[model samples]
Target: MKLTKEIQDSIPFQYANDVRSGKITTGKYIKLAVDRFFQWIDSAEKDGYHIDHNSGMHVIEFFEFFLKHTKGPLANEPVILSPYQQFTFYNIFAWKDENGNRRINHVYEKVARKNGKTAGLAGLGLYCQSFDDEEGAEIYAAATKEMQAKVCWEQAHDFVFKGIGLRKIGFKNTQREIRFEHRERNGNVRKGNFRFLGGDSKTQDGLNPSLAIIDEYHAHKDDGVKEVLESAMGARQNPITYVITTAGFNTTSVCKAAEDVYKDILDGHKIDNHTFIMIHDLDEGDDWEDPANWVKANPNLNVSVSMKYLKREYTKAINQPSKIPNFKTKHLNMWVDAAETRIEDHIWMKSDKKIKLANFIKNGCAGALDMSSTTDLSSLGLVSNPDENGIIDILPLLFCPSDTIDKRSKEDKVPYRFWKDLKLKDYIDFEGTDFSEDNFWEKLPVLIATHGNQIDYATIEDYLQKLEAIFLPKWWEYDRWSATQLVQNMTEKEIEMHPFSQTISHFSEPTKQFEKHAYAAEFRHGGHPILRWMMSGVQAYEDPNENIRYVKNRSTKRIDGIIMTIMALAGTITPEEDNNESKYNHEEFTL
Candidate 1:
């Protein structure tokens, strides 16, 4: 519904002169109260809240009655509630009942960062503690981290102690909860108290809560924490739960779940039993750099926020989009792509279907292995014999240390226990090995032993000879056109691979360079979904200058399949000829 200024002005302001004194009459007050309530209810409806109310004022009255006799400092504290704040609190806390018994409701809001979320939450927490149904009602301001949870608690304490005329409510600074309890039901007499607790599953479990406010919910790493907190509300008839957060980085986390739930409401996929409100600036195509977007994203513009700070931040975002994913996600309220280049999910899934371990043995394959000691997985790829057109079929094998395995043992070195656990000891022959070992002999033997069709001593030695004397030299000086043709042909087949360390480490930079020159270059790997897929899994190195030294940042995921595809391409080796005769002799070459 379109909200006009006249309609907005009709709502009651917390202070007499803030809007107009005439708007404070019981009828106008009730209407304004009802309108504020419905505004939130409507927002909740849009977010999938289910309610059977012809008027939202009824719900508001139910909460008002529930809180009417409650005695506390907040009951008499002068409250200058905005029309918007009034509506938000009523909708968030009030719900109708068939038995006329007051029941609490759930409220979830996806708002942009720095929109007075903390203050608003704190105000509601104090309100719930002071005036909600239960005497000495417990209120909580929770967040993903200790600092964030504490901030909400601190804000609530400040509002109680420092806000005009609120000091009469016994606000005591203590090691644990701030006490606001009153003994008599008379005006300004202590009756009930509210306490603040840090946001943690363990800390939240012991509290019997009347209301719970989760701040910065998008950052919550544990979904289980939410589950645990919700259980505490089961005993309260009208316990309220509020989840507040800004836009999240990607769809895999709690932020994404909130976004999805919001979408489900709009799409009519879910009915709203709870209130969900989302206030963001840009829709889809709105310029992310525009300063106007900031104003739209933050509704509290001149009230709770400084325009000068926003302007400074906006300028920084426009200039360097790549440097700040969190800033862009939170301040600009935009979804940042996970990486510069993401491999389409469809391509990766399809490639996975074509990978058959048996095919490598059946086709007389050759192999390539890339090993890493720091920050990467050891990867092996095997290629099948060339077809009439001279293209190789590739497959991949990836190995990494287990999570339980300690990186540092008593010696303060990365433990080799993971290598043994993954059975990598058999695949990797590190005996008498060092970084300076000759490239051809050092890696070739291990590759052959692990993946070769024939593993006898003589056969293995002979195969190494063929690869070193013939394959290595020809591969180094192979004609660019022939090599390109071979790679192009292999691209048609669905390749089997998982992410390996070496490919993930080097792929991003090369892919970036390739993308920059994609249209101008003749044989760009940009179109290769498999290559791009592997590149997307790469994590940035801690050292800015060292792009090649990357560790597997996400262990549950892999890029070994794409590494296998690359190695398959590398297997398109041909015999070298000297004076029109095939030469199968090794020659020493300087690195």
Candidate 2:
């Protein structure tokens, strides 16, 4: 029943231990990732899973034995993986299912540039192709551009041509592919192929890949290549879809979408056992100038990317100023403008406790609306009165035109159609059919889909009336710019409509309060998927007077739901307190 020292000092757990002991510096996501590893190990057997240490180290030993540094200061030297890389390799190949197949088949790795990502993965591509006990394995280096795909494929090709182990074993190659053939003990000939598959390639038809190395995945503008390769892997017995990249500029890209899902998995909002996620980035509010903090982002600080090289880039960014975004994104592994500070995401996730809405319905609540545009998303945010525990429950009801759900979902890169169809029974706990018909609020879907190509105000008014009959909010607040008709209609219906001006003076205190509630874990939102997405994309703008308000710049994504939450929380504050400065310590809002 006891484990060996080698198992205790396994690469992943060793790195996790180092992180806990302060020997390693990283962000909260990495902390969560290591915790996930430990939790999985603790329950592996009960969950019909087990760890195979030899199988994990087999991949590592393969790299050290056959792969060589194709290009670098250590060119032609044997490929020796660093601690972080050892951790990555072991995780990829260690765990086994009940059937002894690879436990994790998909890997999402986000790290800073110049971290030897490509070389390590190129070696992995070779390992999966030549060994791994898979016959006729089809390995691919995939990317949006042909040249980009060739980068990894070329490194892998060079490793085979330049290295002694693979060459002596015999292989054949073309400009874009490498082939290996062997005869099994049963006298059956097995063949393997490794090549580049680009989105711009002439034909992606009729292909099967056992290992897909998606390099610099953030550069991909869409999911064409990723989806194609993923779908093609269905026939393989044990397939791996490996996406490796640094932080990027495009927030709505497929890579960012994958990152969002990965974050949810780490936050315990979603369960995905077959996917492995490791994100290395600087923690929020870290002083980038501090050399001590650099290791958090650059795991291979002195190994592949030198401290001197980072110093030079940092100096240039300081002098040029405009280059700061690139420096922060590529070197610090920060998503730069994509995730500009509004709130700490980890703290926001921590506050995502379940809410039994029925518990607070009769207590009354405050409502706010952000009717963005006739064609885009409109949000209705409701905040419940604080209970004796002082915890506020927030619920967001998003609305979009049914006809435009598909189009808008594609454009915004968020699932509008799925959210639109979400029934109240899925998220809300209406007490014993009192607020439901057939145990479901059929007409009161959480994400309402108004008919036709533009949001139907009449349908919104109707839903408001239904909500009004049940919750009886104290006041309904609206951003005055485009809600004239809806405001008039609701006011005539005897539903109190108060105009909440969208200004720093009106929003700053509430925004600060929301941040306070998030940090204190005093709010619950049922882990609403769409609301969490909006919160993650919010960017804050600060004035000279230290007033902060969420802003959606050209580069930024939508924050309509977030704005609605702030406005709704604003209505809950006493009018006298709304005009006064926030009582919370200013330093606490630094995040």
Candidate 3:
């Protein structure tokens, strides 16, 4: 634990100790940051922070004041950095704090395309806009389009007009911004700016930035502009959020749910020391025509990349299989399994038709529960809306309490008493509940009761009186956890429930609205076998941005009746259908 002559002349800390001692050919989170950076440099006094070699040699002397080739054969020279960009500027300016602050405040550097990562995170957003001592430092580069947020804001405006004290920079470019003013050590003077935002921008809340270069975050399709730039970074301090990217085929992005939480914190199964992942792909089933697995995802191979332009695009993607998913998702960063599924069990067994619930008497349904965890198994799901042959039906019931339906039908071997009806302390089939243990049913005062693996409000007011005697439900969305007698009987029968919360900001738009009407076949269901084995045990997991959730993976399986049929098809579908109030007439009935 003695290393410091600039981290022993770092080359990204000797290529993260030669990719953690195998002599390099990377991946596996740079060998899990070389065993979590020498157990964080041998427990910097039991992990509270230390190493600040003058904020890591003032970001390696501000990248030696620029110039090492803005273009061809070394255009001005000085630059010199490439041991993984001096190991990401010595692990992001040598992790400080103890009044020095900056303890890696979020950075997700996925690599690949000419791996300099948009000119080194646009030169760390121009050193957090004029030297990291943030004071009015709102710096951005974020993108979704404004031509991908002006590719790292025109390379941090050509490295602040080609270097040298940022070319005597006084700031102020205005016309889309680039400002500067800084001056601090207490004499005070703030103004830092440097902008460019756009996940279809409009309002990203009152931002406080202090450095936010998200550039190409997998062309974001929701994480609501990284949740308003992380809730406008609570008026800044240690605010970073960097996210630089490359591998993107949109596997329900938020950059593929933060690349599955940076591959579960590089497989030690998650710890997150303020998120600093460096995922340079290519490992799983390597040999992408092996040039040592293409330097295990080009960490600036031959600096600014060129093994003769990746062997001429790996010989035109080994003979054009449609250019092998854009050269394995842009110069091999990877995730190209772009099949982002929702249903395909033969179109979900061709929406297994069999409809019944006395065929919708009062009309228009919606009710999607989803409880589980008292011995697991709770779902009620309903959804009817699109009928004039537009199909759209779906039922699913499930429950399971008659003493854990014979131990979850021999531990989920399936047949749970044929979608068992309802019976908590024992049995009361949706209606007549004398609950008998003697007098007012052992004071259980039964109404939707079950208090162990939760679900009470006993068969929801007898399934809302047999679903309003079939069809009559404009709402009832449930999912967050229930049983306070179903929110006190849906607030005493004025029933219009709602609750939803299953995060990824409210189940990522009803999971892409139940994957777009179940891939447009519209949706109808009944052959039930525990809702077709919980829709072939769905796996969805995205959430670093455009939410997808359906949790419990690695095959523990039980998609709570497909999450109460996508929370009753996200309040019974609506992409604009007021063809005079989206249907249901029963002679203008008054119930």
Q: Report the number of the highest-lDDT candidate.
A: 2
Better of 2 and 3 by lDDT: 2
Candidate 3, 307-333: lDDT as tens digits: 999888888655433345556667877
Q: Candidate 3, clashing residue pairs?
A: 11-83, 12-83, 12-87, 257-544, 374-453, 447-458, 448-456, 448-457, 448-458, 449-458
Q: Would you list the C-alpha lDDT of every candidate in the order shown? A: 0.45, 0.78, 0.65
Please list the Cα RMSD from the true structure of every candidate, rounded to 1 decimal place. 18.3, 19.2, 20.5
What value of lDDT does candidate 3 attain over all alpha carbons? 0.65
* lDDT of candidate 2 over 43-134, digit per residue (tens): 88788888888988898888778877876577878898888888888888888887889888999999888888878888898888777778
Candidate 1, after superposition: displacement of residue 564 in Å?
A: 26
Error of 2 at 552 (Å): 15
Q: How far out, in Å, is residue 177 in model 3?
A: 13
Question: What is the lDDT, from 0 to 100, of the residue 80 in candidate 1?
Answer: 39
Candidates ranked, most accurate by TM-score first: 2, 1, 3
Instruction: List the lowest-lDDT window of 10 residues for candidate 2.
Output: 576-585
